[model samples]
Target: MGLAYIFLTSSWWQSAFNFLSLWLLDVPVNAYVTLFIVNGFIAPAILCWLYSFAMLLYEKIKNKILIPSIILFGAYEVLLIILLVFQPSLVGTVGENYIVSRSILTLIFTIVAILIALITGCILSYDALRSTVPEIKWKGRFLLIAFIFLTIGAILDSFSWTAIFLVIFIKIILIISVMSYYLGFFLPAKLADVLIKDIQ
Candidate 1:
């Protein structure tokens, strides 16, 4: 996911991609427009990340729905990849820093992707929060916060905001999301103990 951001937003990576496209395809790729191709991959990356969180939650609760959810998400990701490969233009167009989806198909896909993340987060957090186990509850708290931040950041990022401050703020929120997600799943035992003790 970080790599996707780097390639999509970083000027250096954009330049590299442009150069590659020009050399390979014998035409200059619009650096911003090229983000259409890059954005397609981002959705799949997000789904994969969400899946990891779901898997961890499943380990704690042993939910039967996780399997079906995985299959559905996998199919959705494959559909995105297929669309990207065959009809990238139908996905969307980028102007400045924001994207304007080209067709209803792309818009619907984007909405579905967001909903998938939200539903997964809600399920994991709700179940974990209900657990009598303190550790599970703590992880759930972080996961909930992470998802909230991520959703807000992603929405804000989709806009072509001219304000520099807005862009910075969005990036900060996204960074927080990543950090919170990491802690949710891989928190250190000692730190977790200390925090749980304080809360208790």
Candidate 2:
């Protein structure tokens, strides 16, 4: 769990680095492209790999939850890969053109991705809450709340730029909240003991 949290945080930091590149270097396009390649594409791939290993490590206890989570996560990764591949086209005109391409194919893929993420998140949250560990429960609740706000903000962003900024702000909050939760709750010996026991 600590390692997972660390990788997740690192991914977000890479995202922050991309943001900084855009803001400070006045190289928005290149920065965005680089960010997409590194943080957006590669980061999620790494996460999927880590999650898979974690699932394997605790298969006996977590299989019911983790198996489905892994499947959904895999779907999410495929969608993310597709998104990354077509990123330039998707964002070609501020996502307008792609919006216009809202045909069955696009809609199906979009829904698949959204559903997988939503399901995986819910399962993870449930697992966290049901754990005997109090710290893990709290961390789960924190992440649950963050994801809720992030979802709302993302929905709102579909309306206007103001909402887009709100999405960005919410994402930052989620990142901070997750990082803090990881450091405070999951990085200690307690979490390590729990994880080791789970694996065993």
Candidate 3:
């Protein structure tokens, strides 16, 4: 779990590197391109997380969802690999310096992949909240709550539901997610120990 936590925090490293690249190195990487590269670190972290979710789900339902999860995981790997390999041609708009999906088909595929991941991600979070161990259980709850908000925001954003109220709602959800995610890390040491314990 401790190791998993460290890997989960890999995004922090990506952010740090991106920060340095843009500010200190004066490398004007396109924001989207930088984001694409940064997200590379999340796959492993999320995989560990899905394992946590699938474990709980299996215990409850006796269904072998892990196989599907593993298959989805493989597909995710292939998608990213294909994206990276073909990025020069796959994404890039005229007058744009970095990658952005240039084709409607690619864009559709990207959106579908992301939404599928998000749905499974939420499942993983809910499993965390329901774990038998009390100490780290709230960690899962916090993430669950945050993801609820995030999912709402994402849905709203995806549909171009940009009415003033909806926009504000999304912003509020973003704020809640930020608070909730950080709150999970600030638990009592005993709880932290439970939360950080490896799942395997």
- The lDDT for every candidate, in the order shown, is 0.62, 0.48, 0.53
lDDT of 2 by residue, 1-200 (tens): 44543443332353455557768995543433533432343234334634654573455666665567567656755765576566634422223211112323333433443344445555666677788876676666755664454344333322323345654675676566556445434557676577557856
Candidate 1 global Cα RMSD: 5.8
Candidate 2: which pairs clash?
A: none
Candidate order by lDDT, decreasing, is 1, 3, 2
What's the CA RMSD of model 3 in angstroms? 7.8
Model 2 Cα displacement at 25 (Å)?
A: 4.4
For model 2, the stretches where C-alpha displacement exceeds 4 angstroms are 1-19, 22-25, 31-87, 94-111, 153-168, 180-200
Give the top-scoring candidate (TM-score). 1
- Per-residue lDDT of 114-199 in model 3, one digit per residue for the tens? 46545765676666667787655777777667556655554453333325686567667666865666555455776566666754
Which residue segments of model 1 deviate by more than 4 Å?
Answer: 1-33, 46-88, 97-104
Q: Give the higher-TM-score candidate: 2 or 3.
A: 3
Candidate 2 residue 9 Cα shift, in angstroms, is: 9.3
Count of backbone clashes, every candidate in sequence: 0, 0, 2
Using all chains and alpha carbons, the TM-scores for the candidates as numbered come to 0.66, 0.48, 0.51
User: C-alpha displacement of 143 in model 1, angstroms?
Assistant: 0.4
lDDT tens readout by residue for model 1, 48-82: 54546545655565345455656765676577667
